[model samples]
Target: MTKRQKRMAAVLLLLAGLSVAAVLGFTAFSKNMMYFQTPSDIAGGKLPEGARIRLGGLVEKGSVQRGEGLVVNFSVADCDANLPVRYEGILPDLFREGQGVVAMGHMDGKTFVADEVLAKHDENYMPPELAEKLTTPDGKHSCAQFKSMGGST
Candidate 1:
């Protein structure tokens, strides 16, 4: 073949190999992608049953209940709605009522069967997921600014 024809063939082969590599990379990433949802989203029937997902929201006040076994029940809320969750394991030290948490598990009918529970790290800091919702465009918690200011009584 002519030199010009050989050069063109080599370029075409390289392009084809790059396209195949891109497709393979995308396929692998898509399979590993896990989405997080709020309690309201689950209540709205946006998620399918038996699908693995991360559910994040505030732990509902007065909803935590301890059973005889390791099983425990609690309700997670996103201000607009709440979801009941059941978990069988030791609770995290930071887990408590009225705090942000993310539970990873599958749905069993209306209840979320959590295999793992992540709680908020500190009282001053909000969970990353929940903080995003509470932050304004200027990157500040809207509610936190309104908190009482210290002054002489």
Candidate 2:
């Protein structure tokens, strides 16, 4: 084969290898990409049943119920909609009623089968999955800040 032909062949082989690598990388990333949805979003039929997803909302007051075998049930709401979640594990220290939370799992009928749960520390804090929803319009803190005893605004 000519030198130019050999060079072209090498370039073609390199492109093919890169394409294969890209496909593999994309496949791996796609599996790890969990979609975030709120109760309202899911209620609107935007989510599919049994699909892996992240649900973010505030824990509803008086909706937490602890059961046997490390099972806990709670209701998550975004004011407009609410979803009941059943988690079978220890919860975070900050997990409480009326606090922001994000649960990762799949939907089973009307309830979310949570594999993991995260709770927001305070009004000024948000779970990593819900940070985008906490952005302010003026680029300031979207969450309510705690005031000092000295009457600082």
**lDDT of each residue in 20-124, candidate 1, tens digit only:** 999999776742443456665666655566999888777777889998799999987764667899999988888977767779999998899999998844356
List candidate 2 stretches off by more than 4 Å: 1-35, 122-153
Please list all clashing residue pairs in model 2, or write none if there are none: none
Q: In candidate 2, residue 19 scores what lDDT?
A: 100
Question: What is the C-alpha local distance difference test score of each model?
Answer: 0.73, 0.73
Candidate 2 deviation (Cα RMSD): 12.3
Residue 145 of model 1 has an lDDT of 21
* Deviation (Å) of 107 in candidate 2: 0.7
Candidate 1 matches the true fold with a TM-score of: 0.58
